[model samples]
Target: MDKIKIRGLEIWAKHGVFPEENVLGQKFVISADLYTNTRSAGKSDDLTQSIHYGEVCQFMKTFMEEHTYQLIETVAEKLAEELLLVFEHLQGIRLEIAKPWAPVGLPLDTVSVEISRFWHRAYLALGSNLGDKEAYLRQGIQGLQDRKDCRVTAVSSFLRTAPYGGVAQDDFLNACLELDTLLTPEELLDVMHEIEQEAGRERLIHWGPRTLDLDIIFYDDIVYDTPELHIPHIDMQNRDFVLNPLAELCPAYRHPLLKKTVEELKNALTEPEEAHAK
Candidate 1:
């Protein structure tokens, strides 16, 4: 990724925790580093191929003036989101909001809050075994698409598979999806849980039957495990239900820790499973 930097743009606004500060107003300096690929603009010498810093400055000025928040953290956060949303070309951004001339009446000249925000790629495994299974899977994808921070890019055709974990249940409709989102992994998990609830899913038993089940199998090659969730999805490599549909959409996407392609992993499971049924 390349960079387009906007430095030390100042905004005088009514923003602070204290009543006196909000009423009196103060000066805040803001800076941003917009991340993107600028190859097209460089080669073509085209304005349309690049982000316009001048336009961004005007946007920041207008937005800051229009909204009054008591906290600089709030301003920085909302402003960062606004910039990312308005500029589709931006993949990541580092934002800093500085408060100068504080009423401390002593030493410090200014204080600032800095933070970075970026887009993330995630892969999801989908399954449904209760009610209209296909409908449940489709509804899950639709719900993801409806979210502001989440975008569904690709969806694999649903496949039929026997329930895993050796639990007795109806055949499951399984599939995979690719998404780009701005939400954190924890936040994304919350959304997935909400979708499961909406689909009338019940968690009475482990690997139990359900109206829907959605799992976060990958998040940009990240790997970690927590009591509530696991990345690279714990047993994803060993499960055909997960790898089959996943291979359809992203054959080349490899497990970061396992170093296996979706196709390779699927084949590894399929060959033995087929031989066993003989």
Candidate 2:
């Protein structure tokens, strides 16, 4: 990726934990590294083809003046997200917020917070066993694509798969999709649930049957777990119904937890009864 850097740009902002800090604004130094492809601009010698540092500086100036936050950490995070949102071509950003004059009586040049944020690639498994199955799946895909912070990159062919759990109502039409999203894992889950609701999915049983089902199969190289969601989906590797279609789209995708490629998982699927056996 090509580089666009803004180093130590001074600004006056009211940001701190103390009440006085908010009343009396202090000096802040901001720096950012924006990443994007510059090949086109370089080859064509066209300024329009590349990110304009001047414009970015102006935007930063305006943004700083407009917003007030209690912590520099919030400022850094907001700026990183804002930059990525404004610049469609930018892939990632490293942001730093330096406070040279902190209230603490310490002999230090400056105190700063630095963070890096970027877009993530995620694969989602879609299935519907009840109602108009294909309609529900297609609606789910459209909902994901319509989300503000996400883009659906690819969709695989739908296939017939036996019910995952013991309560066999009927086979399901299953497919996989790839997405480029700026949302975190939890945010992605929220969006999935919203899509399911739009599809009128009624959760009567645990994998029993549903109008629509959306599960996160992979999320970049990140591994996350909570009471609500898990990345690299817990049972995806053992199910051919999930691994097969996923492999068709991204054979190189490695499960963060298992550390194995998708193709390997697909090849390792024993038989139809394996899901039940496990």
Q: Pick the candidate with the highest lDDT.
A: 1
**lDDT (CA) for every model shown?**
0.90, 0.87
Candidate 1 CA-lDDT value: 0.90
- Candidate achieving the largest TM-score: 1
- Please list all clashing residue pairs in model 2, or write none if there are none: none
lDDT of 2 at 40: 92
Clashes of each: 0, 0
- lDDT by residue (72-186, candidate 1, tens digit) is 8999889888888788788889998998876667889788899999889999999999989999999999999998789899999899999999899899999999999988899
Q: How far off is model 2, as Cα RMSD? A: 4.2
Per-residue alpha-carbon lDDT of candidate 2 for residues 147-215, written as tens digits (9 for 90 to 100): 767889999999998887688589999999999998889988998998898788888788788888999
